[model samples]
Target: MGKGPMGGGGPHGMMGGGQKAKNFKGTMKKLLVYLKPYSISIFAVILFAIGSAAFSIVGPKILGEATTTIFEGLVGKVTGSGVGIDFTYVSKILIFLLGLYIVSAAFSFVQSFVMSGVSQKVSYRLRKQISEKINLMPLKYFDTKTHGEVLSRVTNDVDMMSQSLNQIMTQFITSVTTLIGVLIMMISISGVMTVATILMLPLSAVLISFVVKRSQKFFKTQQEFLGHVNGQVEEIYGGHNIVKAFNGEEDAIREFNKLNDQLYNSAWKSQFLSGMMMPIMTFIGNLGYVMVSILGGYLAIKGSITVGDIQSFIQYVRSFNQPIAQTAQIANLVQSTMAAAERVFEFLDEEEEDQFAENPVKINNPMAGVVGREFQEESNKKSHHHKEAEREVAVVNEDEIIEIEGSVQFENVHFGYSEDKIIINDFTANVKPGQKVAIVGPTGAGKTTMIKLLMRFYDVNSGAILIDGHNIQDFNRHDLRSIFGMVLQDTWLFNGSIKENIRYGRLNATDEEVIAAAKAANVHHFVKTLPDGYNMILNEEASNVSAGQKQLLTIARAILADPKILILDEATSSVDTRTEVLIQKAMDNLMKGRTSFVIAHRLSTIRDADLILVMKDGDIVEQGTHTDLLAAGGFYSNLYNSQFEDSHEEAV
Candidate 1:
């Protein structure tokens, strides 16, 4: 928690360039790796497809053989050469062909089963990995990307990969296998016709290849346009209040329409390109079929092949060319899945700090006595593992410390969101810890940035921060933060009971403890007066609850945690004056015996503060107690006098 408001490199920075996306070949290789986990299932799918393809050629072969046998029998009877062939053998052959088709159908079903499992499992696993990465990512990542855009990646992109999996893989195996098997059968039946079919293929292949490359370009653009549209919506909805307050509705509408227009154009092109595959493939397949029929029939008439042989050769030719055409389109889907894989893998590649450390501070039952059996048991465990138990023990019972003396001391801190503009400006401050330090300044005056630095959200560019005698970097982030409770001006709460919102401060706290915390924050009576009492449900971000209660709930949360430091940024600015008075008492109770960093707007709040540091342009202009600063009649005095001298005293 680098003296910042929260554990983040204050959320003001843009995303730096991320990992370059993998190209087509790289994407295909990575896509293949997802199949590695389901190799057995994929292998089965392929095998079934191979069998189905191989069996397909058998039907046409048998039909051609039967046609020859039947014609031979007819010629024998008519020519009085009945002994030339046996009629019963042809009957048996036809029956055998019937059995073969049934088997082919069965194998086709098994192929579907195997491919479905492979695709679904792989997609599920990849989504899980991406979800885990999102959790492990630092807050800085979310600062650049909106929740909705990120949400789209997880859902739409992943679904694209999953949806095409079975179709692509199964089609690939069947198409390629059928093409090879039928080609071999055709060669045996009539080599002349086989040569002719092969000759006509290269033209169609080259045309499809050109179209595929074009399609990929459109697909890439289509994906980017989607992200842009998602970004626009996320921003517009998230900043709805800002748009309304500033009366920039026209500007917002125009921006949204621009993004939406681009999305529509890109989508149309992408769909058109993808839709071209089937038409292009079918045309080529038909042209090849016509070529085989004409050439094979001409060869038979020229006594180069038998009529039955020509018929069978034509069937094999259609079987062969048909799958090749289908495979071309399936190849496009395979490529798209590879593209999705590139996106998914890029997310997982981001480096995350290791979460599971060997030693972390554990706060036992809070109400447990320092020397009681429960405390001793927890103490023994802490001393055995964390190694900072001694200091924690001393601070547990006392409010003050020696080295820090309610003062946050920065030795020589230097930091930035990146190597870009430095926000802290070689920040060094002797903020007396536990002192009511009021930081007042204009927006972006490094006010909230100061809180982020002290919290150690990001490692300082250089230097050390000491709390007590300990450098902050050595402390566990969660444990260190447990000592300070922060209530931001913009409050956020989860969708749950009001009790759970307050209980978030101490997850294991009892109902009684929760009620006690609420009472301390003057919210107990109000909650009891409600229909559900403590069990009342709060909507997402606590929108179901009033603004004042939301703040009070957070205050209760802080009181429950009972931290040594409290951070209140415009804590009372959101509620009415009557609620403010009620909350002021609660705030005082929560701030007692703790170091408080207060970012207050009302001059009345700071007048009572132990130290009022007037900040402007990211630097302190004046510092002293309220009276002393007013006596000097400098910047602090002017800011103080302005409140009384100023009009529009509606509320904070």
Candidate 2:
């Protein structure tokens, strides 16, 4: 019979959904590639499974000999033919049969032991590859896919693969072995009985195939709905406070119920179809059993077969149906596993970021500009201070100084999130070392997008971002990013001690350094008042602290990083006026003598910026010092005046 689609197969049993794979054959082939390394262990497992099945297949036949011996002896005694029962011979046969069973059990145990190791190791390796793949994937992937979907693939899908692997291999070998051995034993005793039993196979196959075809679609639907449910739950829980504020809990529950209902409809149908396999197989087996009994009796009456042979053949008939049923069950499991494998392999094959260039630049010291000895030795003939006109174009540090001066320039840049829609077009700007540049714009005017490009989080569609007279892309991504520190609007603090959160900027920093950074950010006194001082643990959301205090902790982190360049994206926007003043003071200290890019929504904050670039519709509409822009009376003037027009008129 064709197999029913596979759903969740372990303790959840029929209640679980069946997730059918679209490309079963292709996915299985890819999965086998991973098993190549464990081939030797798998081969040994196969041998053990075969041996175990072989021994079990011989047991019924051997036990029949003892049955026959006891019967003959009893019959002779009843007929008074001077022959009595041979208890010793009967006991010997029974002992031999028991020995065979013990051996079979041992083989089965060995097979299970070996296969478990193989499955777990394969799972371990796949998890490692997936972990590494996460780092290689571009930010675009995370942006496009939900957190729940990615997490399901990594955890649920990988786990499915591991459990299914253990079951499929051992069951497959044992089923085949038992099927073939039972057929041979049955035929050796009575061909007519064997033929009768074999005739029912086609009928069972027809029933199973019909059910399988109908169930496949439901299984596929089940998985899709399951993912949707997970995504909705994750979204609702993550933003539960927002949901509560907006009175959206009912809507969230409604959405979850819809997805859950879809899952239930598909799950029960797939479960019912698969659950029918064994009962139907048992009916077919009973039919074969009755037919074998009648046919064997006729053979015995014709003197063509002995009583012992008929008994042995009957046992074979019963054993034959079991493996047939097991094979069908395993077939269902195969579909589920293939579906999971497809997802895992799809994730592994995702496009990775561009490869690192050979001899990429390295920033050995944050404060110094000295080139590595290797670079200097290779180009020893070049002087440390080569004239700008004489600089080599082939290498990033051709001028021999590997130091970053924090000077940044965007030359004729053009960028778009997609090809058809350009956002920032032909924008160019230059910031000299140790200058504070403020970018002010309306929402969606490409202020933050520029910072992303500057960090090489996403490369520009065209044109170059140069740092210290070298293109940012020319340096290793790790080395290039190390020179800059960012404090974004959304503060990220993991569940750890307060001190540990601050030390995230520099993992190896000492306690003294961490305390100094906290003092610099003006949060030291507040932390000292806490119950545990710096040792106080922050929960997952860091909700134990106020928003302003969380902002302070992030500022302290940036201070500890001590980067050559700093990017602040509205670092004070979320706090109260008093807290904003404190944050501004801390920021001023942090920005001292460091090239900084500040993205501000409040016009008042950028009044003293060295340069102010007012943005409109992805273009820089005006750029100058605040006073120069006010004197010019351009778009910047209108935007700045709009904020305080009422106050200005009242003062007049």
Candidate 3:
């Protein structure tokens, strides 16, 4: 709460022992923008805020009158100035002030409750939008930022903004209102007393400004340092085994200590500044007290003012200073929360991909000199079915089938993650419907990159990708992604029943359909042997399931979806020889009547592929049928020889 456990001071990325805080007005302004949608809730909070503030103004005045009445009653009874003592007036005023506090308390509760509910709902909407945006963002975005840092923007930063809404708006309005009301009372009571009382204003203001500036800097630094530490912790958690294997315990601890120290120093500065606020103010308050006593006392004795007037002036001075001092303490919390707001707003501002496909490429539309007599007789029926099939697989459309041709073509494509690095250079490929293609390569050879491009994960820099005779880019993104079922090297499984895991492929699929798909993938037997069969509760990421089992489950899930274009990346890489053989058989049957792309490490799977692209350094050096490429005496020949035919070590 006080800049957390670690301390660093100054605006984000500041270095050294101390740094000055920036003005908080700009940060606060940016934060208020998120509240625009909840204007009604904001207005409600303001109305209550004003109610509480007015109650506060009335409270002290009532209490002061009660005190004056009691003093007059005690002194008047002794003198017997033809007046008897009466306690009823003082007690009634005290009761009225007490009632004001009770009502103010109720308003405070309502303001906090309503504002928090509205803020949380907005947080949910913003997070959902951000999640959808990232889902469609090009892979380049994540490459430049860690998953943890991105998560922080969603979870931690958004929460910080939400948590501060009540404190920021409600308290700020109440304090400001109280300050104005108190000043109005002071100026009316006595002109000379009011002027004299305000003389201490300049000194108190300087102390507050200095402390607020210092605290804000420290708090901002604290937020940045905490984010850095969170990112580091996430990385270590992901690679804990690898770290321990490499003897990185000491290194990890040292890195943590460095982050710890920055947190420590920043927190120290913020609290030190916050701590000084009260004392410096108290010292200034004491000076005002002494000055008012001497001046006020002389005026009272000279009959220039009454004793009650002097007492009330002293009371008014205390009321004004107390709020200013209290508000100064939460300044650090306000600034730290505001810094987090900036990071969250950055994510909320990211652009989303195109969603509409009102006029996609027609089956009749074709590139110059590309369409031929071979497609003439049945092209219309084929295109109609293709679009309908695509619509069916789209997640958003449970009942309608999206139309898209299964045929795909990359035409002289050039692309890269950034200006400095070109990943795909002049790449071109053609996949007729229902062709089984295999892409093999060494690490960093753009094998996966090709698959991503086919899925429209990124747009080509120069050329176009076409499905059937139409450019794929012209199609709706939902329709485009729905047609392909992808199973990556790393598997992700949600926490749910075994049946639910398979049903994730197509949410509308029946339980019987899921079981049938599992049987096709040879995973049904394993599920039956489990304690609860389809209803068994799966652990997070499916840890209870073996790695091979996890792979099989996901594949079965994909089979249920029955995507026209199947992407199996190292589908058998994790299983043993026997299981791999079983899986390979299941995979062969699965690929028989549908277009498939396979990336496998074992040499046997791709031997009969319609096309095998051997890639290295982001370029395809050889492409053809297995028999044809081997006969060509090129890069493919050399690769097959080393990988398969130790017997035939032929010189190129």
Candidate 4:
């Protein structure tokens, strides 16, 4: 859970503790724009709140009328000049007051229901938009922020905004209405007492302002430390095993305690200061009551006001201070809400990846109809040697289908994660259709970077990556990606059944097709052994499966995709020697008619590659066949020889 605006002490603690927005007015304007659709609902809430406050405010004044009636009747009875009391009139007043309160309560309930709906609707829209926005955001944006930080904006910030908006809207209107209504009622009772009550405002304001100013820094500190604490806990929890293995538990605990102590210090100070507000305001309110009582008594003695007027005046004075306090609390809440809004809007406004091309060139697979039919005929001729179930044919509409031969060219490609540092500089490569090209390099040789550029995860600072002679950027990103399949060193499997995870490659694939793809990647036998067979659910981390098994599942997914181009970035790195050989055979079958780029640190695996590109410091220093590279006795020869030496030494 993310931290909200108000921490341990609740709303009162947040009176002056909430962080202020950098651009309060601008953020508020944007928020109002977002609320435009709910304007009518919000307006209804305001009207209902005012109506509720108005009825509730009128009760004290009307009840005072009954009080005056009883007092006058009692005095008359004592003098033996009139009836004792007007019980009938007092009863009527009480009945009317009861009806007014009932109506007020009904209005209050309706407004609350409406406002609750509006706030929830707003939250729903925000979450939906944020979820959508995440897809559109550039990969670069996520590179700079943690997953937790991003998630906090979605969960905590949005939640805070929704809750605060709900309270602020209704409470603001009600408080203002009550303050004004109470003041009017007080004036109608007696001008002198009203003036006396009004005098307490300045003193109350001074005390509040002083406390707020003094506690503002502590509140800010508290919020900052709270985030630090949450971040630390999340980080440590995620990597607790690593920390323990490294004997860093004491360090982690010491760091946590430091942050915890700072949070405690600031929290207590802010909470204590904010907590003082009620007592301070209460003292001022009590002083106002005393002043009003003295003035009301004098006025009553002079026959300038009745006992009922005095009673109403005192009630109005009490009501007056409440709205003032509520307004103060609301001000802080509004600020907090705006701050959360700013963070949400900031994410929504981030630069999105250019997903679509203005004039997209449709993919035209020339081999779909004529070549495909010929291939099927060829397979039928060889049916005696191969099982009928092992042979497969794709039936696609010739008019709608388009495919590329998977020819790729990197023409003077230059790129860097940042402009100041050029990693892949003026790199060039050409891969023929259906050719297996191996990329071998050291750790930071820009091997993965090249794949990223080819996939358009990031564009080159200069030069072009062409697919089937069309610049990659010219094709729609989605369309370009559709022709490619990737099985990376780090396998990613979502929390789903094994069958569903495999089907993720092609969502509409039938169970038979999924099983065929799994069998092709050599994962079918292992999956069948699981407790629920293909129905076995992988946990969130997929920890139930071995790393090699995870890799095989990903390979099965890629096979299911049946991409025109295949990228295997150390795809068999995690598997044992036997499994690696099996995977290599599966990969060989998968790569037969597709342009495949294999990134491998194990030089032995890529011995059969059509072309080996030896890269060093971002440039391909040598390009040749395995035997030819060995004959050249250059960088590739040295790297291959070193690997052999390491293996030989290990065996010895």
User: Of the candidates shown, which would achieve the greatest lDDT relative to the real structure?
Assistant: 4
Write one digit per residue (lDDT tens) for candidate 4, span 1-652: 2354546654545524647689989888878877898999999999999999999999999999999999999999999999889999999999999999999999999999999999899888889878867865777888888786788788888988888888898999999999999988888888878888888899999999998898888887887888789878988998999999999999999999999999999989988887888999899999988898898899899999999998888888889999999998898788778888988988887876765555555576332333334534654354221123433333345464345889999999989999999999889989999999999988899898899998888999999999988899877566687788998888999999999999988776899999999999898999999999999999999989988889889989999988899999876666788888777777877888999999987898889999888888999889989999999999999999999898899999
Alpha-carbon TM-score of each model against the true structure: 0.78, 0.88, 0.83, 0.90
Stretches of candidate 1 exceeding 4 Å from the true structure: 1-35, 66-99, 146-149, 164-168, 209-270, 299-311, 354-408, 425-434, 528-536, 648-652
lDDT of 2 by residue, 456-482 (tens): 888899989999888888775566777
For model 3, what is the error of residue 97's alpha carbon versus the real structure, in angstroms, after optimal superposition?
2.9
Better of 3 and 4 by TM-score: 4
RMSD of each: 8.6, 6.7, 7.9, 8.9
Error of 4 at 472 (Å): 0.7
lDDT of the structure predicted as candidate 4? 0.85
Estimate, for each residue in 1-652, the C-alpha lDDT of model 1 and write its tens digit: 0110111010100010011235878776767776787888888888989998777678988888888888777788889978766668888988998888988999999999878888888778878777756755766777777565566567755776776787788888888888778878888887767777888779778886776566555555555665666667767787899999999899989988997788677666656655675677678767777877788778766878776786787677667767876765565455556655676666677655333224333334243223233433443343211123342332233322122234567676666788786665555566666788888766677777677777655667777776765666655455456567888878878999989989988777899999999999999989999899889998776777788888888899999987777889867776888888878888888988788888878877877788776776655667778888889998777776777776546453
Task: Give me the runs in candidate 3 sitting further than 4 Å from their true place.
Answer: 1-41, 80-84, 212-221, 303-311, 326-342, 361-405, 419-421, 644-652
Error of 1 at 7 (Å): 37
Model 1, residue 110: what's the lDDT?
95
Using alpha carbons, what is the TM-score of model 2?
A: 0.88
Worst 10 residues of 2 by lDDT: 382-391
For candidate 3, write residues 445-490 as lDDT tens digits: 8988888788877777778888775777876555566667887778
